[model samples]
Target: MIEESEKGWLLDNGLVAYALRVGEDGVLEHLHFGGSLGSLAGFSAWPRQAYRSLQIDDRGKPFRHLGTLAQELPFFGRGDFRSPAIAAPGLDELVFESARKIEGGLDLGDLPSARFEGAETLQIRTVSRHMGLEVVLSLTLWPGHPVLARTVTVRNISDRPHLLDRASSLSIDLPQADRHIVHLTGSWAREMHLQRHRIETGRFSFGSCRGTSSAQHPPFIALTDTDTTELHGEVLGGALVYSGNHETVVEKDEFGAVRLQMGLPGGMRWPLAPGEAFIAPQALLLHTDRGLGGMSHGWHDFVRERLLPERREPYRPVYLNTWESAYFEVDEDKVEKLARAAKKLGCEMLVLDDGWFKGRRDDHTSLGDWQADPKRFSRGMGELARRVTAEGLKFGLWFEPEMVSRESDLYREHPDWIIGADRDRPGEGRNQLTLDLSRPEVEAHIESVVASMLREADISYVKWDMNRFVSDLDDAKRAHLYMLALYRIVRKLRKAFPGVVFENCASGGNRFDFGMLCLFDQTWTSDLCDPEGRLDIQSGASHFFPLSALASYIGPSPNHQNGRISSFEARRDVAFFCGSRGFSLSAEELEAHASSVKETAGLYTSTQSLVTKGRFDRLRTGAEIIWQLTSPSGDEVVILYARKRSEPNPPFASVRLRNLEKGSAYRMEGSGELWRAESLMVAGLPMPHTDHRANPPLMKALPTGDMATALLRLRRV
Candidate 1:
């Protein structure tokens, strides 16, 4: 829905609107970008020249100043003194040249881009006076979504090369400066926790300078109204589709205007030779009047439809991974026993994690040597895979493809394959060195080896893990180069193994980003997957990623990560909300909880379509975390509740329902109680109690203890 007018252009998709017009000085001025107004009537009428104040430009015309107006891309050397979108000399202002509307999106050359199908793109071309630099700012709009993608391309038409120190994919000037920034910041197992603060008069910036987008700071930010909540108010969010070193900045200028920018970090030096063009990473802006849920649903739907359409549509498998069960000791005999136990538990796949490779007794050896350990797998890796598949289940194999051990055959033969192979003592994380994917030989080696493993076996799933970071990040260019190469290899592998489901795991949640989600089908949510400990991690991740892509698995009691002993039911209840379900249990514990495991797996098979792919809602209660889900067709409703710790004689625990038809009546599944949708939404659903509401008095109370969990299901009647 791109409507070009005499002034500029109007990009609307029924949900979000973005309009821009040429100013008096022939500069592209941003008119409106939040909510839709139905049409482009009287949009940039007076304000194209109305924002003049006491101060004036060098030419003495007050509104001629670029600093006062909202621009498509602000300049540094001209009148604007704020943070420029790109750091390059001789960049006066991007004077408006022409804007063309076309079907599908603009091509980003070699960079990874979102789907161009069914999307309308507006490319506004501008040029500077000094260096003959051409700037094309692209905005892509989807039909029924409140999300828009933005990117900037710079081409050097001049004879001289230009040095670009910083380049952001998108930059916008908002009229308001008073908004709170909501960002996710945490460490390894503790990833994607929501942290927010009100905007003030200074620059508040955060980003990941680590070679990879670190677990400390993910590449997402939201500017919300002060009264915004999980289900209400205004939230304008920005997410970068990049997996490398990145930066997001929210700055408030002295004139009370806030500028938001997302793209590459400021530390790298990028040279653009004559006739060369540089394309920044993509940035998605989502506007939602329904607050965070609306923002979240927009991203989730985009990921499903535009990002990984084919990969996301299938039934996410329920598997039993052997990470906790056998760790590095997962041999052929161990895998056979686990496959037997997994089949009885109704698991669909049995993933052999870490330790099947040649000479790989531990993480410190044989990582890049992608072959079966002859001693452990007496027959071969393929035979073990065949054995698992023969036992009425699919097989999954784990590989740290991007890492190499110095002691392995791959590293020994080609030491130069490592990131800093020339150094005498190159740094290492997790006792392994990162493969230099930037090298063509390295990519070919990894692709050939991993593909050979898949060809030899009936590998239905693959868990791709990267246990280390780029330790030699003295040059920021290394991060972006490695990412580009990694993307190329991932795309090749995806095309080669069309039937295999690939899950990305970076020590858990480090690669939990949209850039990877665009390639990998799913991600291991976290290594600390105990139900209670994962409450915050999963909740925060749900704000951005769809449940279908979050791998939430139930681990052993006295949790392997945190040592927290939780009930089997509690663990299963928490894992139910995530789309990709699985468990990692020892042989003894598998026998002990066989009935419960099979029953829970059966319930998952029955309700997964409704619970996993549904529109999820977060309702907050002080000490309890609750998630409500609505089926895509609007007939079924599911709620998962967890109490961190219980109290004696606690207050009545009830929570409101959302997103139901007003006149509908739903029958609660277990209790067989019928309730009207309006009453359930307005009056709320009471937590099950020991009262007479239960036919039998003095019955058990719901959520009765620490790490307690409860589930409620309602079907439309």
Candidate 2:
């Protein structure tokens, strides 16, 4: 799929074509990055206009400078004033040297990368014309998707060490295309709320400088046409394959050209020795003209097909966790009871969350000590796991492996093991300190402790939680190294226990990016399990992730996080939208709402596939929020409809469904009425006549309340 074209290089994956050629100045220039052209048309960069411009080439040739031009890897100096993708001291002028077809893909030593199948990899080598620095630009065109995964490795080939300053994963120029930036921004429990603005003359940037990929600004950005929507415009989606500090910048130069770059944060002074290389984390760029829905579908298919590590066991689980229910008070007897209750509730997994470790009466004491609480579980955790598994449920345990409590013995012995220990000690979060996994000893200790727990107990699943952020935001290299270390530990554990379903939760959904998505089986959508809050969080996350990766759960009536009383029915309705659904209600709460709880479990067991793996779309959002999920074969459709307030004699409302086959007839599950797919999508089906009756009153009464919810299921006849 990679061939030498008339112009330069054509890297095509039978679906999308990414063409690049050497400019007149010997630097690589981006030609076209859209649909295939049947055959190469010798497309090249447009003519440059240096009218009233200041930048110039080496020979003082005006209008021939790199500025106002589209470049492959924008250099630091010599012309382009915009931010460069790769930059370092004494390494400014890097010209295109040579390019060769790489075998499979370059192994990014410690950084996480996606597995490529039917991928055409081309390594374009660019070196400084003056300094002896080499930047190997590796680009992989993933099969069957308009996705390009790029990683830049800078090697110091010079005799002396060089200071590496800025290195981004991928950067591309958009020539004269109208682009509007769309991003997700929020805080801890309120994560992934959508935001957007049109790209103006100035630069617009969004990123996470907080050590962990902050929910406030996770590493994802979309450049769309001015009128882009869910199903209707060209969208260029960029998501970083990194869980640490990252940034995305969209710049509009005076020439009407746009440059978008995504990668690690700037201001890094890491040392690059004579022969040493710095491998950046991979970044993905997916292009689709079919709109945001198309972009999401492409990413979803890629993540499922290539990003997630292959597993042996089926993990479509309806689980119950002990967090909101028991918190730090769960004992062996309590866990066994929950396991039995989970089995009776038709749950497949029972996760004993965060209370089994020794000296862990509260969050202040036992995080590093991974031993079972002898006083709570006299027979040990292994026996308890057996007891849970005996009840036809997979046993899952919680572990904050990257954290240690000062009150624990592990920290008492090795207080210097925590991050920022030698320097200024980082302030504690949740009464715990984050272990410096960048150290070999700390990494080994964590790997040993986590693996031991998995082996000690029949842990079919693990709730890996990081409840804090990194201390130093200034050290980009340190954050990068910590991420690399974390990925190493996770990769090893994944290989050792291929069947265990690992779920990543950084105080719930903070680490919910593609990197963690690929590393773990599922991600907690949010710690806020309230009905409306879950809807918003899940909807925003659904913009980038498949429903299968977002773990949606239902808690008690008076939601623990928000203290907003919601019905069990309303909570279950929202949770059913995700692939991984769970319940975190205490025994008293469960007993109070037995019928609705039982109904949810039975329905979830029978129709999980329709909800979990279906194609998802956010139909509408304002007052009434609607979600649509259609089966792959176009036979079944599941729609979740919820409105917060009960309207007073409101106008007739209906939802137009999406993703159904044309000319097909779908039979409503409960109503037994058949409706054509086209008419349903276009004209829409009228919702329940809630709060008011039709002109002629109907016989049945719809569920009317403040937090009203309804589920509609249909199958092709």
Candidate 3:
């Protein structure tokens, strides 16, 4: 709810509140943002007097105080020396002129934005008449969420076109200067690794110019004080709802005030013709004083409740993907064998990965042609779907609809359909060129092709993959338009096939962001299935996403990507914690461990609720890692993984469980040992000293080995 008080405006959404006041000069100034305060009465006592000293100037230009004060919309070339959220070489002088409340969210043409039933919105309009540009910044607050969704719309009100050198979706002014910035950074195989650093004096920024939301830098940034920890301290997080080229800038001004801005990369000069408008991507901001864990929970709740598709209950199918197993060698007979093996292992879905389309034998061809390969699938995909269904498994297929192979019939027939520069040959990555989704005809063609294939084959799932970065495009606006077009196509497909599940993959996590997650069911976490590497990847990913949004799979031993062999048990344990559990190995090859696979499947079924909808806690002690998942109703499970051999001096390691009811008595599932929650949390569970055990050993003596894994379940009694 938003209310106007005598001193300022108060925006409170049950979980958090943002308070700001219109100063004597009519400039909006940020006052406070954090936990919900229920009412605006507290704002009267806020330190407005302290800012009086900083506002003193003989010239009496109130705008000069913007450097010391918290501004709602600070612009470049203004007296404010801080980094401008919206910078344009054409419009060097811009200032906030007025503000107004809006009843509903502002539409962004074809772009996607967050919306909730009871959300309130406010628009602050800043104008530079000399430069012929007007910027309308919108902020939306939902009633029960701690997040504030923000976006900016730039309008060219003059006779000529305006070019924007920089524009941000949102900018936040933090009160304190001594804070730590936390961001996710890594390469393709190791995406979303958490990295934190103290805020410096100048600008600290990271972004993707790779055309896609590159794996090197995810669209997430956070700020917290030195006192912050996993379970304690205030944390403010911002995640861009864009999957294309994006950037985040963090700056600490001389006045000891920090400002954070996230939006389109600075390299692009977004053009806006007269009477035309350019709406930047949305950015979601979350504030939690309960700590990083609280902030994570806030993000998870928002995604599940507002972003994901509505379902009666969370669904996580036990899948067996044929990508790593069959690769491009899949045929009717081979797929049938895999389906039989999947059914025997209690898998519920069989996803046929790449190489099923026309004229495709390898990654070098047939990406845009959605038709089944006549030579490889002689019986057709419909027949294969039936066969898989006959084995009590649902069928899935893979497609790279947004890309086209230069060697395929689609590109040969319509060369103009691909995005490229005027004279440069379209740059190729993985032997494919990006489809010009910005073109209406190209988007329509892709929609028709993908929809026809799904309708023809009765595909229950679709693995939408984009294997290469976008390039060769001369116009900067095309990149942003391409993402908008992709969102429109996915939205249309979701409405057309409401029952089909979609998994977003872009060369493995390149497009992993809340924007895509809002449309797709889950994301392929990474191409690297090495259990050791996954431990770090999954852990880092869980910081922002819920378990259910992460697609985890066990690949063949001596993992296909990294060639690091791991025990079947270790791989299964790592994959089980993810919302969707699957394997990328042939079912037939797993016959030797059939019983163990069956047992793991059964265990997943029994604990699916705890793993998917539970609160997650990570305990890292040296090389040993313990992940605890606890349901709201008190059922809990923990997976203890040993990444390396145990040391001798300590004799044993201990892990204390979190989020338990201290007074309640709990029983361990396997050993039948019972203990009070308080005792267990205080005394802690111990690690094993040996590698083998007959019966379920106590925490004091768990199996010890390189990549050894153990499971512990608990129920409150």
| Highest TM-score scorer | 2
Residue 13 of candidate 1: its Cα lDDT?
Answer: 83
Off by over 4 Å in 2: 42-47, 312-314, 695-702
In the range 157-262, model 2's lDDT, one tens digit per residue, is 8898898888897899988877888899998889999888888987888787768888899998888999988889888889999898888989998867889999
> What TM-score, computed on C-alpha atoms, does each candidate reach?
0.96, 0.97, 0.94
lDDT of prediction 3: 0.80
Give the C-alpha miss distance for residue 700 in model 2, angstroms: 7.1
lDDT by residue (tens digit), candidate 3, 255-276 = 6778999999875788778998
Q: Write the per-residue lDDT of candidate 1 for residues 373-486, one digit (tens) a residue.
A: 888897998899889999999999999999988888888898888877777899988899988887888878888988999999899999999877678756666667788888
Number of residue pairs clashing in candidate 2, backbone atoms closer than 3 angstroms, sequence gap of 3 or more or interchain: 0
Assess the local accuracy of residue 344 in candidate 3 as a C-alpha lDDT between 0 and 100. Answer: 87
